[model samples]
Target: MPDPALLSIKDLHISVGSRPVIEGVSLDIAPGEMLGLVGESGCGKSVTALSIMRLLAEPPMHIDSGSIAFGGANVLDLDGPALEALRGDQIAMIFQEPMTSLNPVFTVGDQIAEVVTLHRAISREVAMARALELLGRVGIPTPDTALTRYPHQMSGGQRQRVMIAMALACDPQLLVADEPTTALDVTVQAQILDLLDDLRRETGMAVLLITHDLGVVSQYCDRVAVMYGGRIVEQAAASDLFAHPRHRYTEALLRTIPASNAPGTELPAIPGTVPPPGQRPSGCTFHPRCHAVVDACPRTMPELTGEPSSDSLLESRRMSLLELNHLSTTYPGAKGAVVQAVSDVSLDIAAGEVLGVVGESGCGKSTLGRTLLRLVEPSGGQILFDGKDLTALDRHQMKAVRRDLQVIFQDPFGSLNPRHSVGYIIGEPLIVHGVGDQASRDARVDELLALVGLPPDAGRRYPHEFSGGQRQRIAIARALALDPKLLVADEAVSALDVSIQSQIINLIAQLQKRLNLSILFISHDLSVIRHVSDRIAVMYLGRIVEIGPTETIMNKPQHPYTQALLSAIPRPGVARQKRVVLQGELPDPTKPPKGCAFHTRCPMVMDICHSVRPVLEHPTGSPTTGQVACHLYQDQA
Candidate 1:
């Protein structure tokens, strides 16, 4: 006979106030298995996780119907003490944000000890010892001294580890981690995932990992459930789900990935955005954005039933608008020291090509974008636009060039003036550039709003009045107001939800094509970078460590830094593969390592890597167009 499910939800329904948020959701997880729950933001992924723990605030949320069975007991029917017992003893959950989950006033060790003391009936000293042990097990260095440190004193990765330790204090049979690694650096994410998998194997615990990153879901999850509009659109083994996703939403999500799309092609972004709660469409919620939508789709919902299969196919195939020749930017530090933000970074963006620069935070990805736009003055090297060296130009000359070299900053809220209407904000650029009179600028503003898919009347709305996606559209329209030839989009879509991110990505692609615009897209997200970039440059410690076509850099990464970054990406549906977990945080730019900056954490470091800098060059017999700055590839050439 087959083993019974460790946890099972049958026809679950949840309501928030008068609105239904989760409807007819059913899923199961077996013992010692990792199940992934995936969907875009506000798609009930976190709500589902909260439901499993019965952690929802009763006043605002209530389970209307359904049964949550755990180890033959209906968890929904458990009494207060019974539910309390079940919480830390049999089931534990790690919340999405560590900073918010943990109390700032409490020491991390004390927090974990509280869980242990509550559930285990252990003495304070014993619980404290247990907490320290857990901290050590979770890979925190100096676990002994770390016991006294508050959550605020720890780094993001360290704080997350504390949360995990607290959740595992009682050795619960089931662990629910909701977007545990979201917003974390790729290397830290890899480490956290590895620790979770290791702990699961050691303790024989089942893990339900809820995240929007399909790549992460592919690598760490054993079974997968694709959730949309409060329903399980599809569920299957990881391999089967990735191989052949039957649901159109799933298929669209898969196609939206950078790895799935070929370089220099338009990303296959799903149109529109996920409907707001209480506003979902009748019959099928995803019908509006689905490319496979039919007449029946809007009137009838389809059952998710299909066999899984795999397939692979590939198809192939610039006037220089902006160029950088060994461009460098530095800032004076506290004691005669200097912070190198961009170091001898030489690259170029063609007339209409997107050159994506990707790296971890503090790796100077944003600084490079700012440098190219001349927002940050270069300490050395040259910034050339249309064969004219920008560094040699005076402030007045550079100001004149600003009309054709615009920027879209990461935070649309801060970038856009909240006090001003969209019309005034966009027209301000035109006014500054002396492109048109007030009447002409107003007409141009309306035209620009239409170009970014906003309503003609949207110009009257303030920045705060629009949604995150809409605000981004406003930002785009403003950037296009001057008919800029080159645009610097620095982490433009990083703050948006996945579905909204796709829309903005598509909008950028459309604008690029329509305006014949050259773009310098800077972000820490490799998947998004791969999706929109013709060429990619991997940066580390203020230097371009690797540069190549998107496909070449992604598929055949020659630099160790590039390889580690790629390996750290969570590929949903693919089983856990060998990955290089980079050690330590990004080094202080003021005191960067003497040689190759990445050598501090690189897995394949050599003696020379510690003393001598490497030059970016193509490897011998590579047969691909790209460059790698690594000592390992030096011999290959």
Candidate 2:
């Protein structure tokens, strides 16, 4: 059943410096449910969140015309005192980046206590006690000691928890969480997600979650609203939207995420960048970059409909391109401790595909890719490439296959040496494989640079001389130099901005088709995985709990843990309610849970989950449903 509206906005028109930043936007947030707002960066997502709190500053910006209703009262029309009363006492918010939101100089405890006392009229002693309890409720260990610690002293995850505790301290009916987990590690992100889910069940508060990630929308939000140029272009129930996104923009978003089934399908990005506010085109804002764009799309806007065509209705589905069999990697930790990153995980990748692996920091997505290339010795497992056993090859023997395999790492600048120019970096690979000498290598480097959308002369520039995006281009050139069939990318674009990230993703896509190079793109970004991979694998501490086609895993994630991790991505450009942001911290890898790695934080945890760990198994009814290890899929109730 549809939830009743808790907050509503109509004719929302906002601007910065006489420019229309948000235009004619309207949305609804229902009671005890989350509405996900999503789009790319600068799509007015943050601005919309600010407008809800009546927090837009003057001069450069203002809400020209809009009716923002909270508890049936027009919040935009409220006076300062009335608004302040509503903020903590009625509606609370958790902004993006808690480090910036928190006062660094003050103790975390005092900050939270201040909110409680100011809103509740409680004594300082009572407020402090309440603050400590809230802290504890948010799952912060040593809540009392944590209170005295400053914002800087705490990790990014802790600060977020503190922010949540403070927001909830007022017992507000609405919670607005804006990209709360964008910068967190996988494990920390998992803990935060679990906590948020718990809080939502307990408080019955409405949640408005804003983010750019579709996976989060699929898992956490009951309904999703996709934003483009400050307007909702698409919205529907989470399952319906993910299963059958109407707008071309929404479909493109789903395609961008990496998957586990198809190991190296090139990620398809929406063509072109999201235009800046000032430069927005007329009619349908997404028409400019949409491949399925029609002549009418440029002159007429598409409305947010309740229905859209499902993916299965499409004429054809993407085929697979790569595969991994019995792949395993064990890393040695302190004092004889062995951390099995990818333990005997076997999966296949068909022609022209991407298999996206997702999990917390230590979940082994990156490790699996490395072990495939023998970068890390697989203690046990078979890595078959085109029916040939990779495990049998020595470094020298593997060198023959190295020309068909490549790797792109995160932090491109760190990967390239400062002393050598971009030309040298890309050329080194060609020279190593005896393909070309100095002059030929130089020519090849220039061609590669041009292929990656950089100028020919860019080859002469030093690593430090270019921006993050440009350096990454150089890194790609280096990876492609060997002209390998497979490319392994380890957190390749996580540190980049949205605009730059899209550009890099597009470049990779173009290059992949042109060269037929299979890629192992690794990252913590679920949206990227969805857009890129044909299939997705959700990893926990080390094992992959869920593996399925992109549509299945994303639209109806069988595993509870997969659902939570998907709920963590930040959707940009939409205005919706926040969710149980997420809960708790990642469990310790050295001291993992006894049975299911995720059982410690699982929402639908069972008794057997704590004693007998489940293996990566396929559903009996549908053998091709892909592999999911969770007991949820086991019973299929």
Candidate 3:
């Protein structure tokens, strides 16, 4: 009645040393179906995918029990030659980090051609031709030039496309993509996802997609299996799981995302963290974090069953906290040129509100955030905070203003000092500001760590000892040390895994409520921006193109750029919509276009857009009190 599974794993038990990682995990991927494996970091999503390919190192990592069946054979029992024959022929894998996965010495084309030659009895020239064809198919521009380029010569997205081309070299029966789009920008992510979907349709290849992004799982995968602490917590059709999650863990995860709730309201976060290997709680691994915990939850594992009667809106009211009037920040470039990193950017963030700024890299969102904190001194315009022009404040005067304005940078590791202990990192703010003595600062550091969901003793450790997510928590603790009224969180959660990303997002929301701190949240992620922001601002090369209520900007985007971004978001379980892929990269800031900077890439570009710059104004019949900078709305005014 149904197509047989292209790949199947039954009763899989994996262990690294004496500690078990994946216990009795089972999964299936039918031909032409996309299966998403989701979980937090260290939850065996990647390990399981590796196990399917027998890629796990033998001594430390061992597969004690399980059968990975593919193409009517048990992959576990295959001999060296047989396994080698199977790999890259019938089954191929695209790893999360292409930089590390691809060899550094070889050209991308040489590597891809090698795979083609190895699998098929083809000449080097034939293989090279096939490699070029694969590159073009995966949307890489100028495949001929790319053929000679090494992995380091390419951008992250380009490298990933090369990885995909190599994976599809043999047109394998099954494709295993592990967190393929995690590090990519949303536009590139959309392109990669689209490429995968297209390849799947054309070749009828099954995809085993593993990722922590629930948004991706919701939109891309046909079926979903949610993993928790190395075990399958829940499995169902993607739509069914989203509509009605049976497990508490699944429900908590779905409810915790910012987009799932109302703007400004605190997100429901899953308490505590996943336990270390072999030290799982006696019965349920998730019992510690489960909000719907029963008394027996700690002693007995609840069978995955549907008994869910529950659920969840976020609308944030406005109260002006900070305002910018024609704010501009610029830097001198080569030969008398000026790079307008941020130009005439005017917006406001309400008290205890998240005003999200979204744009591609180099669109000036990060510069705008820095300008708000006076980290980048505004060359022009006024930055009004509590009715005072921050630009006019002297160094001594600005030092006091700095107490109310703090920032959290994108790279947590880079932002934090390597030589400093966690305690010192968090307490330094208090020390520098003359707020407390050494003993009092230590106590305050502990308190701040607890507030951000880190253990009190985490203060004793160094930054390198902690994971990326933990390091970000430490950064937040430091940001909160000054009791700042406004936080410039520039791409704060962008570097984290999806599950950890949710934790940080929720933590920010929680802190925003606890301290009533206004946030200038800047990121390229539209889904995350829509979830947390009270109002949304879309920026293009050095200028604000649109600003509106979150609902209006996300649901009914008026600006063409905003519309393109929203459409690019990969929603799970839905057929890929016809997206407006903005052609070409971001324009050079030093030499921008004559009028609207976005006109070059805009699909609905008009003659007027090329000659006259648009201003932020209420679009005709706009449902909300939002503004757009577009010629399309010019007549509406």
Candidate 4:
């Protein structure tokens, strides 16, 4: 016989101000089991998770009907004291954003110790000791020093680890983690997930992981539940669910993952966004956007059913549109130390080709992008654009060249002016370049907006008036206003929900083809980079470790850093493979490693790697094999 469920939620119906947010949701998590609850944003995944812990605000959020049972006890019926005891002691939660969830005023030690002291009758010294132990367990380096550091002083990954440590202080019977890895890099994300899995096995605690990332679910969870329109549409074992999904919604979501699709191919994005809480359609909330919608889908709701469910580079031999010849960008750090943001990078983007620059945070990918456009002045090396040296151009000359080189930033709202209308924002480039009159610019704005799949009248609204995805579209329109030959898309779609990300990615691919524009796409997501890039460049500590055709790099990465990155990517519908988790955090940019920049964390590091720097070259002495910078590859050539 199997063990009783550690956490059981039945017939949960939650409403916010008379509007149903979660309707008829039921889930079960057995002891030591990890259950993934997945759906697009606003699909009630978080609401359901919050309801399980009784964390929802009272006035706006009320449980219409439901029961959450933990160890056969009704959580909904608990009084104030009982609820307080239940929380942190028996049930702990790790919220999505650690920065906000963690108390900013306290040190890491104080915050974690408070959880221990509150749950257990322990002295401050013992609580502090426990906090240090938890920190070490969660993979935080130098736990003693980390305890005294403020939340703002640590990296995003470290902050998340602290959050995890605090949650596990009491060794709760169940842990509710909501999008814990959403903002983390793939390497850090893998480490955090692995830590959780390890701790679960050791402590025998169940986990309810709520995320939109199907890839994470496929690898970590024992079972999966699919939510849509505030209801559970499908639930099954992870393997069974991925292999043969019974629900149409589940099938659609699997198709939308960039890793599951071919390189440079258009993603089959679900049409329209998720309907708001009070504005869901009559029957199926997904019916309007569902590709496999039937006549019955719009009029009749479907029951929850058991289901088993399941880049080629640009080939055109065009001339180089942009060329970086031994490019380097350096910034002066504190105490007159020089930070090597971009070091000795050399690459060329063929006309209309998409070159992806991928690495973990602080790897100099973003700095490389900024340097290419002269937004940050380079310390050395030449930037040749269309046979003209950009470094040689004066301010006036660069201003004219700016019309041919434009950029799309990651945060749409931050890049856009709140006070300006979308039309003005899009047409500002034309005004700056003195390309057309007001009437002509307005016409151009409408054309640009239409090109990005936005309605013509959308220009009348401000940035705040539009959704996140829509705001990104406005940013794209603005970038296209000048019809640049090259576009630097710096983490373009990383901020969006998965469905919306697909839509934007498809739109970018479409526009790239239509305009025959070269793109320098920079991101930390290897999966996404593979989907949109013709060629991939892996950066490590301000240098390119490898550059190759997307298919070649994805299949046979040569550099240790590149291999580790590819190995860390979570593949949906597939079992987790052995990952090469790098042992240490990124080295300080101001004082990089003596020889190979990645040697400090390289698993295959040798004595030579510790003393001699490797140059980027064809690993197998064949141009077609691509360039790799590593001591191991040097001998292979």
TM-score of each: 0.51, 0.49, 0.51, 0.51
Candidate 1 residue lDDT tens string, 1-637: 3356788888899998989999888777777888899988878988888988889999789999999999999999998999999998899999878999899998888899999989887799999999999999999999999999999999999999999999998999999998999968999999999999999988889999999899998998887889999888877777757864657788889999998888999998888888877999987799889765544457657543221111100000122457788889999988899999999988877555789999999998998888887888899998878767898898999999887789998999999988899999989988887876888788888878878889988998899989999999999989988767789999999999999999999999877755456789999989999999989999999999999989998988888888899998998899989998899998889999988898889889899999999888887556768988888878732
How far is 62's C-alpha from truth in model 3 (Å)?
Answer: 82
Runs in model 4 with CA error above 4 Å?
A: 1-317, 621-624
Task: State the local distance difference test value for candidate 1.
Answer: 0.85
Candidate 2: tens digits of C-alpha lDDT, residues 1-637: 3444678887799988878999888777766777788999978888888899888887689889989888778998788899888887788889888988999889999999999888887799999999999999999989999989999998889999999999999888988889878898878877876677778878888788888877666778877777888887766668756765656777778888775126777677677888887899987888888776544456656444221222211212222234566677877878988777777687765433456778778777888888888888888878777546888988798888877678888899888999997788889877778885678677777778877888988887889989999989889988977656578878888999989999998888766554445566687888998887767878887777888888898887778777777777667776644532335667766677887878777878888889778878886566567788876666633
Best by lDDT: 4
Return the lDDT, model 4, position 428: 95
Error of 4 at 232 (Å): 58
Question: Which run of 10 residues does model 2 get worst, by summed lDDT?
Answer: 307-316
Q: Which stretches of candidate 2 lie over 4 Å from their true place?
A: 1-322, 573-583, 620-624, 635-637
**How far is 241's C-alpha from truth in model 1 (Å)?**
37
lDDT of each: 0.85, 0.77, 0.85, 0.87
The clash numbers for all candidates, in the given order, read 10, 62, 10, 12
